[model samples]
Target: MQFRPTLWPTLITIPALVVLVMFGWWQVQRLQWKTELIQELEIRGAGPAIPLLVDARISAEDLMFRRVTVTGHYMHEAEMHLLNRVRDGIPGINVFTPLVRANGGGALLVNRGWVPIDWPGTSIEDHDVEPVIVEVTGVVRIPDPPGWLTPGNEPEKNAWYFIDLAGMSAAAGVLPFTDYYVFATGEKNLAGEPVPWLAPDPNEWRVDLPNNHLTYAITWFSLAGVLFIIYVIYHTRRRGPDDG
Candidate 1:
């Protein structure tokens, strides 16, 4: 079989093929990186809780999802609410309060847990007349960057769609706050008593990291294959008429 390729088709097809293949390869690399991250997080979650060093310079990757103990007094006046959180098909918000470390380390935001949207008090002070100093065990959490579609947080109104450490700190007047926050472990407070809100069990609260790179990679490669087949057929038909 004679293969006569036209100049126009060859030029167009070669660059298009190169671009498609490159995209597919990049997705494969992303798949591997994501898999390793999930595995490391699981191992950290299973270990014993360690004391959080407020002054220590820890990378976000190293601190994320690690169970740690922090002793502090809850700053009820500085509490903030994260909107649009749901549990058991009910809409609610996650309550975040700054914990002023007992050791004078620094103020660390603590995600106390989820509360009903209609829950009367925005801060713990509304419920407790006096402040309480306690030690709590919880899981460290790093805030994810807001997506393009996510609405901007309103600090003046105390409305939050996502976690913004810097913004929250400034709004609450708690400067020099820790970069990461902690999710309290049980539905009850440190005293083993029931609280108004629900807390997540760190052991059961597995990370829901999405991994769709494999599917994306297949689509790009398929498109490249289809393009190659069309190019060959077009050239072959043109040669057939000349031969006859």
Candidate 2:
């Protein structure tokens, strides 16, 4: 029971096979990159806190997971509430307030951390620090934009689902802020922690980040192997009338 595969079908498969292999290779590269990033986060997050120089030319990559101290006063008037955030099985939103640097620099957006969803019933000022001059020790974090499947931010409505510092700052008139935001690892001031709020800890977030690139790479390679087997079998199992 032999059937012949035409030359055209075999030729077409050549490019198709190459593309599949290329995809597998790309995923393999991503696996290595993700592994190194995960390792760096664990190592840096455990180190002692350092003074953050907002005026310095530090790249976000250099600042990831590193603990730093920020001295500034909260700008309660321009706070942004990041919706769709939850902690410890409780639903709530995280508060992001702009900070005016004490050392005579531009403002920075500090993720002071989460609070109850009903916070609007009261006022963000209620969580504000008493002394204008306050010190916050936290981990440096680069905010991730809304995911592809996530809804887009509505800047005009002041409703946000994820962190987009540039848009949020500009809309609230808090521009010229830091490119990266700080995840408050400790209490923002002497006022103590906010009620029903959980501070953003990098260690907890790191544990949940997915690292399945290696698995995806193997899947692509396996598909390529299956395709190759079909191609070889089709060409081998062929007979002509002369064989009859």
Candidate 3:
């Protein structure tokens, strides 16, 4: 048998194989990175809630997914409503209120959790309670920048599609707000009205990071292998009596 691949097929196959293998390798790298990130988050999230200080020197990466406590009063008048949240098949919105910290710890945004979109009353006055100092415990979250598909926030209307820390702070007139926000854990009422606050388990991290990179890597590698096999079969030929 003689193995003589056509020039054009060889040229095309080599480059295609290289590209597929590179893609596979890239996905493998991503898989490792994502695994490490998930592990780190789980470790940090499992620890007891730490007291969050206004002047704490903790890096943003260190604070992510970690539970923390803060003493403050909710500035309900400046509440920002995150649109398009759903709970139990009911379309709703997540209410994010600025918490003015006690003893001058600066303000922190707290996601107070969801309320139905058609919940009666529109004004903040309808939801706010009498100003009272309180302590809030929840997980720290660093909001990602709004993607191209995200709708622009309407500060004038107090409607938000995504968390915009600086923009929300400025609009609410809360100076020097914390860069990260807390997803308040536990159910609570809005001035005697029912609101289903998210109560995530304090002992375990809710891992939502998708990890399909390994699957993707395997797919790419398999495709590369199939292509190589096909190329080989195409080029190989049985020798005949006329052959020298």
Candidate 4:
């Protein structure tokens, strides 16, 4: 009777091979997702802006991120500055004010634009610039999720940057607003103080799929091949002497 210990190299190699295959598969899946997302954004960007609320009717209201146009009166009373935004390398504030539809019915919060950080507790003087009815065109986008580090809309304390649509509506004594608001793109009213009309830059959104999976797959398969070759050589050389 004879007993022999299993070769530790082959035993460890099996698990390493399995892990490499799984990692490669995961990266392939990620590449596919990125490709699909880029295609969708391109398609959406090509369409014409929806002009009226009725024209863009649909389920689930946060149409933020979609290009849209609306005319309304700027509700100066409900205006608040979203804190801690940066512009040109300086700490700044984002101005957000409610826009009451000119024809009446509902109000939408407009993210006017960013302003350089001012005194810690001072509000931007609205009267310094008179209110004027204006037309705004821009893409709709949902507010950043709570706890995303953007200043939350706080009317009572007069501090805010992120436009929490639902919260803004509640604070304005208007229940329920569109789940999203327009990022004003052109023809902003009352310019200078509160610069509006900013389109989101998409450089960061481009898909950059990596080809490392093939490299990894090759590495694993190569190692497996080397192991098999060594095993054969070792057994063949040893058995040659045994055969004699």
Q: Cα-based RMSD of the predictions, in order? A: 3.1, 4.0, 4.2, 7.1
In candidate 2, stretches whose alpha carbon ends up further than 4 angstroms from where it belongs are 1-6, 119-122, 125-130, 152-158, 188-210, 238-244
- Model 3, TM vs. native: 0.82
For candidate 2, list the clashing residue pairs, or say none.
Answer: none
Who wins the TM-score comparison? 1
In candidate 3, residue 7 scores what lDDT? 93
lDDT, each prediction: 0.78, 0.74, 0.79, 0.60
Candidate closer to the true structure by TM-score (higher is better), 3 or 4: 3
lDDT at residue 167 of model 2 (Cα atoms): 86
Candidate 2: how many backbone clashes?
Answer: 0
Mark the 10 consecutive residues where model 4 has the least summed lDDT.
198-207
Q: In every candidate, how many clashes are there?
A: 0, 0, 0, 7
Could you tell which candidate, 1 or 2, scores higher by TM-score? 1
Q: Candidate 4, overall lDDT?
A: 0.60
Report the Cα lDDT for candidate 3.
Answer: 0.79
lDDT for each residue of candidate 3 in 1-244, tens digit (9 for 90 to 100): 9899899999999999999999999999999999999999988888898888656678767789888888767777787888877777987787788888876877888887667788754347775566666677788888877889989989898889999899999988978567788877743333454342232322222757779999999999999999999999999999999988
